[model samples]
Target: MMSPGSRPLIPGSFLKIMFNQAFPGRPGVYWFLQGRKVIYVGKAKNLSRRLKSYPRQAGFDPKTKLLLAAADHLRWQGLDSEIEAILTEARLIKLYQPHFNLILKDDKTPVYLTITKAVYPRILITRQTGTFGPFSSTRTLRQILERLRHIFPYCDQPAGSRPCFYYHLGLCPGACIGVISRETYAKNITDIQLFFQNKKKRLVASLKKEMLNFAKAQKYEPAQAVQKQLEALSYFWQARVMSLELPRLSQDQIQLELNQLFGFRVNRIETYDISNLSGTNPTGAMVVATHGRPDKAQYRLFNIRSLATPNDPAMMAEMISRRLKHSEWAKPDLIIVDGGRTQIKAVKKLIPADIMVVGLAKKPDRLVGVNKPLDLNTAAARLLIQLRDEAHRFGRRQHLRLRSKTLFI
Candidate 1:
């Protein structure tokens, strides 16, 4: 029997009865039961440690408040290794559709730069998979395409074709007319791939030296052109470079950063903004940003549910209440209302005390909290502004688009 204050990992009076009757030692996976239904599933290396975690005061997160309220009883299955336990946890979560798990509904189709696997490899912008270059921006990729054409100098035409305009303009390596040997052409392709794979610094330096030599030898026009191409290549490289730091931060780091700056740790942040013309179609927008980046898919637009037309603060409060009722959406680390003190206070009335809330006033960009105006120069303040502004932009665009459509209809 569990001790006083040691509530079962899964909670409910009915589930508590069921859990007490069952054999508690065997552990492969655990399910959190609310009455007869399993709301969450987990695999435990040790059933005791995993089960104890749910009821422990220090182990709980503010976001897990709803889960704790709904929890009733804990059930488990015996498993071999930690790896198997992790795999089992994932499989069970997928099967159960737990409210706490982060669901990835959005497709992960990022754009890529493809070089066709051919003798005279032609470069093309495509979305097809199995390609090496997965560039984030099309504009950056276009710049890369230009630099590639200069460095590789492959033929735009078929093998037996006549020298094209590129060759006439001295851009091609004369591959179309077979002036560049097949061996050399193949070497160029290899070199191009190397550059794309971040092996370009040395090669670019060598190319620059060659261009300077050509300029000294009275080939002034070509040298200047090469110099220009080099500058473009340098910019292309800088834009696509990614940080080599740790991909995802730990929860401790997140909490520490938030606490030191904001006097509280931020688990999630929900920002609200109202968008409308003068007494026209007023709509409220709620954009959520977790940690730092905008989770656009989680963003929502509200077509003022209340009959109180043109009341922006009321519209904001309604949206907040409606969103708060949903079990899946976690309570925000901070609340950002996109208006002055009035809007901030309105939202505060709607939110529960477990969460932190603030507002960003547009003019001079100030943060309006419960008692005092937060200084905007701190790291947390900057992050709060970023989220608030993003919500404003998202809300404004949605409002404008809806208004435009209504006008058209």
Candidate 2:
């Protein structure tokens, strides 16, 4: 009897071998192995598509190539649903320690924007307990806290403290001083919770109506304040959600594809875009997104140091290489460069083939891969373009911020 650890490697006989062995048709976790070593661990709703990817779509990555060369066996465990698959994958990866997966050190504790789980839950920025976030950055967590406070004034003040600074600054709705009624405060908190639960459009529309109402009552100051807040919320929503030509793929499909390609489901994707502005500052920026939402905490600004003059491609390559060398930053499943064929080719050489890479040509907003340009209308293409655009926006914002700071200094 062949031990599971010593399964025979029949060349060109994978399908025949797996045919006799049960491959779970249902959603669940799967593992590819080279004798005793686990090469990659993944989850899938359709085992056929997930298993097929190993041989059919296994793009060459240094680590994947080695795994493929040695892989003699495939195995899987069935799951109830796709969500379970994700949770299972995350758990197994933590336990088994696969080499291909981009596993970061779990040393740093997560900080959360906790609205205390109390009768009158107070909003606070903390690393303490109770529904803490695995948030990408402090800035991002703070922004979320601010938004929550604006929408639900009840959470803005300390539980027992007097009117806070926010009240004095006219940012809070004066909930701390009883200026806002309990019913109104509760309604606001309910709206905020609903928004966080993915009812953004509804919340935005409601806010718009309220803003108009204040204006109609000749309450110009309050109306302007509400309008400004609405604009900010709109900007945040647009930045995070992709409005595309194609019907958006469900979150599960996107997550599964990402996991298969990169060996893990990418939560925060950080892309680096370099720009020269006529070779003046010659800067590079690292932009971050978490679960398709902008995670500003991971955003980074860099002054181009390697080259004296402007070189967007080379500079971008160097920045990416440096970022990958660090263990703290989560490696993106995809690296998006903002350029045409030439730009893609240059960065491609620098990137290890294992990592999925693509370039976005700004002229037509096209995605350029190894040999062909993908049409952005396709679901896959749209997702890639969104990542590239995010990187570009982040880089541009950093460039402007640095330029303004320099002028002031």
Candidate whose TM-score is highest: 1
For model 1, how does the per-residue alpha-carbon lDDT over 358-382 read when each residue is reduced to its tens digit? Answer: 7776423455665544443234544
Give candidate 1 regions above 4 Å deviation. 1-255, 371-377
At residue 257, what lDDT does model 2 achieve? 50
Clashes of 2: 1
Rate residue 260 of model 1 by lDDT.
71
Give model 1's TM-score versus the native structure. Answer: 0.37
Q: For every model shown, what is its TM-score relative to the native structure?
A: 0.37, 0.36
Candidate 1 at 9: error in angstroms?
74
Cα lDDT of model 2 by residue, 217-245, tens digit: 99998777667556545433433212232
Using alpha carbons, what is the TM-score of model 2?
0.36
| Candidate 2 displacement at residue 202 in angstroms | 40
Cα displacement (angstroms), candidate 1, residue 186, comes to 64
